[model samples]
Target chain A: MGTRDRIVAAADQVINELGLVRATTREIARAAGCSEALLYKHFSRKEDLFLAVLLERMPALTPAVTRLSGQVGFATVAENLEEFARAAIAFYRRSLPLSAGLLAERSLLEGFRAMLAETGGGPHLPIMMLGTYLRDEQKIGRVGADADPDAAAALLMGACFHRAVLAALVDLGPDDKAPGFVATLMAGLGPR
Target chain B: MGTRDRIVAAADQVINELGLVRATTREIARAAGCSEALLYKHFSRKEDLFLAVLLERMPALTPAVTRLSGQVGFATVAENLEEFARAAIAFYRRSLPLSAGLLAERSLLEGFRAMLAETGGGPHLPIMMLGTYLRDEQKIGRVGADADPDAAAALLMGACFHRAVLAALVDLGPDDKAPGFVATLMAGLGPR
Candidate 1:
């Protein structure tokens, strides 16, 4: 692997273990088997390196969008929603520790925000994407005409996001409600 | 206020401004106009002082429970859920920064976790309480038999929690979806 890749991997590992503050550049360099000076040569500061790590490690949304698009008209709406929920839940679980660390540091948080702004990213984008998918289902008469797509998306994604948060705070097990929950929602959403 | 109360207030203010690591004992004591020794005497450590402030300032659940209990049979289910969502969202908004600060530090996070365990507290207790309320509504033919009360509770609480998390990450504004969101969920949950 390239020096940059190794360094980024090392930083991710160290940060997950020791958190952002204690995941010193020195430890990251040692783990990457490079000199600390070499680490600085590649990335001027820890924050820059952390950003690199995030782009590489944070789950990309493109595949998920494509997957959901394919399911809207082709699959049963419940099956599609369940598949979407699994992907969203897994992404959130991976995202928690990474984001909590960045949000805890104001400087890092500002830098991260700047990047998102430059990329035209908004936090609500995911919810909007999910809403779009629900709208497609609605068009096909799979979802109730009375249901607000955005609110339904929020309800589903919100549950997944919140579950991840609680898991971070304390050990929480799977609720075994995924299948049942989707079934119930679909029952209400199906044509009246 | 008493010396102890004064010290606690100063510590809360400093911690909120400077975060957990930078809120030094001396700084807090100076802000409180008390000797560092007296601060220590009142609270053995900063964590203890933090806990006191949390109890005093954090949004309490008593009022919410009382309000919800009164609404079980009287108000429309939609009204009760909307009212509950408002309270949960407000509490989560207030709690985001405080918990993020503590979670940033491993030692402090462990200390806080230990305290929760000793107090016989679980993160899902509030959700469970909401579930119980829904079950009662189900008994009265308000909620659909198909909707799992626990899952319904998770859905509502999860959205509020997730919204708070996103707001903490970046600037998020009032969604104005609370009322509509509750209405949509109730439509799906109403007897089919």
Candidate 2:
């Protein structure tokens, strides 16, 4: 619709076609039916443009963050956790393969990480949210008193993300493992 | 070493600098102190060279698989699982960053998947082996009978891999979470 949207869309296409290494700004500009100068008017750098594409294209973890925030005390601890994990798993399944294009390119990943660091963010955003929720559960005596919330949160998110990776790379199909996995993960950690 | 090893090492270097997209065969050959013809004689395609690099450079899961095989009947189930997870985590920490190069390129990744298929292997081989070990544990009444060995295996490996990704991308440093995480994971699974 707009030039900016068109440029971003074109960048996405070029990335999908040639991978991140070959998706030059010139190629992206050509795809957008614009001059390179025009493309630079919207974004200062190629990494900036790539960042826009990534943020716009990848599913945001914010909605789940919001849901976890609201469900802190009301739901069963296991229920709250399993649901949160399910949301993460779904997001990873969709984004993992697509995000490979960036992962393969060192500079793009570094730029992305720098951008994250500037924003006081990193990949652990989801883990932190889950940690907060788990801490709340521990406080209220829903989860085990001895359980380390940070480690539990990391373990939960890590497993979900890993499962997503398997689904993407190994043709593992849609996740039928979550319910059992969650139960296995949660079995020993209930209030004692 | 020999020409084959030299070529693969050169590919590793070029890939580290330029990522997969820009690491052309010409560049790799130049770096390897060999003619492109000599390089081709050693490896037919770029993907093959990269695979050789991956196989040589990245940590093989085979040793851990062997360790688990022998430990099935001897060690405490929790101890065995934690050690296996540590090995997986250590491997991921080394390989995850290097893997970004593959994730960036579509054809390269597809080529990789095809190669794995030909070898009757995929990334989840370790998970499957661990699952077998856990099943052995279940049969002997060491772990909970209700636990899904496959899911448990997936969860263990998945969590370790995700943590490695974080360490590489998010500056998460060394993993201080594993001991507590493993404890939480094994809490209810032990024989009473």
Candidate 3:
């Protein structure tokens, strides 16, 4: 890996372990097996280094969300939601340590916000995609057209996100129960 | 307020202003007009201080949600759903800062879990309440008994929570079209 990539990887680990409050540049350098001077050579500041870590990780997340939306078939909605939920849980589980770190470091918000806007994914994309899907389903009479698809999409995505967030906090297991939960959610949102 | 409460209150302001990472014990002590030793005397560590702040704030979140649920009446199911949706939105809005702060801090999870279990609220309460309401409505033939209340609740809660989270991230309004959203979700989840 390049010096910059090595710096980011080490930073991710440090942030995960020590949290943003305690992860100093010197510690990150030691974790990367590089000198502090070398670390500064790649990134001007700690905030810049943290942003690199986020950018490196974000690309991996988008495909997991978008791929499910591309699946074809009504029978697949439950499955799609389940897969998406599992993927989300996995992503957060891995990232939670870093996320907690970033959150603790108040300085990172501006950089994080910039990254989210530039990347076009954070939490909103999934909701919008699901909303659009619900709208289309309504048009086909598969779901009720009279209802607002945006709201429905927002609701379904919200529940899944909330559960995933809670699960991340508690380390809930991923099993067949995930699909069951999604099924229950669908039933709640399905037409009469 | 006692020394402990003063410390916690200071921690809350620091957390809100600086984000969790930047809110150091030194800063908190300075904010509280006390020495670092005094701060430590009151709370074992920074995590303990954070927990104190959350414990102080989380309980007040439920009453608004309960009030919203109670507002639902015998009008069109859509009207009731709209009331629920609005209540959900307001609750989320008020809690967003706290949620964001907690999202940043991993140590707060235990406190959050305890709070949820004790108060019978938190992220899951909305979905569970909506599920029960829908189930009752279904049983009474107000909603089709064949309809799945669990799924409906998930759908409704998910949309509202998702929207609130998104709104916190982006500067979006409350999607004032909740009535339409309710209609669509109910149509899907309602009885044949």
Candidate 4:
């Protein structure tokens, strides 16, 4: 692969092992089989590399969310949401460990928050993106006009996120509960 | 209050400020204005003291949940669930910072898991309690007979949790979104 991709993959592995606060860029560069100078050529800050790992190597929630905008009127609302829920659950589950350290340290959390804010990112992205999708669907009579898109997005995504949080504490096994969650939500979102 | 209550209160404050791992029994005792030996008399272990703080000093979710069983046939299911959601959001928000330490370190998380297992407790209590309430409602035809009570319970509680998680990173302000969330879910929950 390319040097940039290698560096990002190495960052993910080291960060997963040592957490964000403890994982050093030098270790990441060594893991990538490159010099620190070479690593700096591609990404200047550790946060930049971390962001690359998040947006690239983490579960594909952003891409799936991006695709929602295109599927506005093409699919059943329930089906679209079910797909989103599955992706969200997987994403949250994969990313929870990375966040354990960030959330534990006050300064780390503040820096992470600033990094996210600077990039126009944070945990709120999915909610806003999906809310926009729901609003677009509403325009086409595919969704109930009175439905509160943002709140519905929050509820649906929040349920997936909660499942991930619980899974972090215990084994939730192979059972897939997202479909049932989306179906129940669909009962409320149907055009009225 | 009494000495026992004083220790529990001190533990709650200390743990909230310093997290679960770093907040020691000594510090907690000092905060309570008591000796270490006296602190041990009221609570045999720090875990016991932490549990007491969670149950007694945090937001009253346990009591609100216990009250649900008695309201099986009395109130609207939507109203009951909404009340539970508010209590849960408050409870989760309060307990999250305390958990930051437990979840961040591998050994600490393992110890916490063991402690929770020994006490027959973890994060599953609320889901089980609310699910039982829904089942009871179903027996009286207050809820749909075919509804998956556990999934519904998980979704409602998870949404509350997700809201708290977001509020942790960014201010969600004074606006209450729990009611709208419950309203949407209730549309599906109402007995046909």
What class would a CAPRI assessor give candidate 1's docking?
Answer: acceptable
TM-score of chain A of each: 0.81, 0.82, 0.72, 0.88
Q: Which stretches in model 1 have alpha-carbon errors above 4 Å?
A: A24-26, A35-48, A58-62, A174-177, A187-192, B24-26, B35-37, B40-42, B45-48, B189-192
Model 1 agreement with the true structure over A34-108: per-residue lDDT tens digits: 999999999996767987776677675546767897787786778888877877777777766666677666666
Candidate 4, B53-141: lDDT as tens digits? 77788877889899888898887887887788888988888888666656666665666677786777877788889889988888887
Model 4 stretches with alpha carbons more than 4 Å out: A1-7, A24-49, A188-192, B1-8, B24-49, B188-192
The residue-by-residue lDDT of candidate 4 on A75-167, one tens digit each, is 688888888889999988777756666676666567677777676678887899998998888788777666777777887888898888777
Q: Residues B117-166, candidate 2, lDDT per residue (tens digit)?
A: 77776678888988898888777777777777776777777778888777
RMSD of each: 3.2, 3.3, 4.6, 3.8
Q: Estimate every model's Cα lDDT from 0 to 1.
A: 0.74, 0.74, 0.64, 0.78
State the fnat of model 4: 0.38
Candidate 1 has a TM-score of 0.87
Q: Tens digit of lDDT per residue, candidate 3, span A1-192?
A: 888788898888887776665678999999999999999999876767876776585434467656754653455556766776666545545665555455445466556656567665565766677666655555556554345556655655555566656665444456433565455545553324
Better of 2 and 3 by DockQ: 2
Indicate the worst ten consecutive residues by lDDT in candidate 1 chain A.
A183-192
Docking class of 2: acceptable
Q: For candidate 4, what TM-score does chain B get against the true chain B? A: 0.89
lDDT (Cα, tens digit) per residue for candidate 1, span B54-119: 666668654785678678777788888888888888877776656666667677777777766677
Model 2 chain A: worst 10 consecutive residues (lDDT sum):
A183-192
**Each predicted complex: what DockQ?**
0.45, 0.47, 0.40, 0.37
**Which order, best to worst by lDDT?**
4, 2, 1, 3
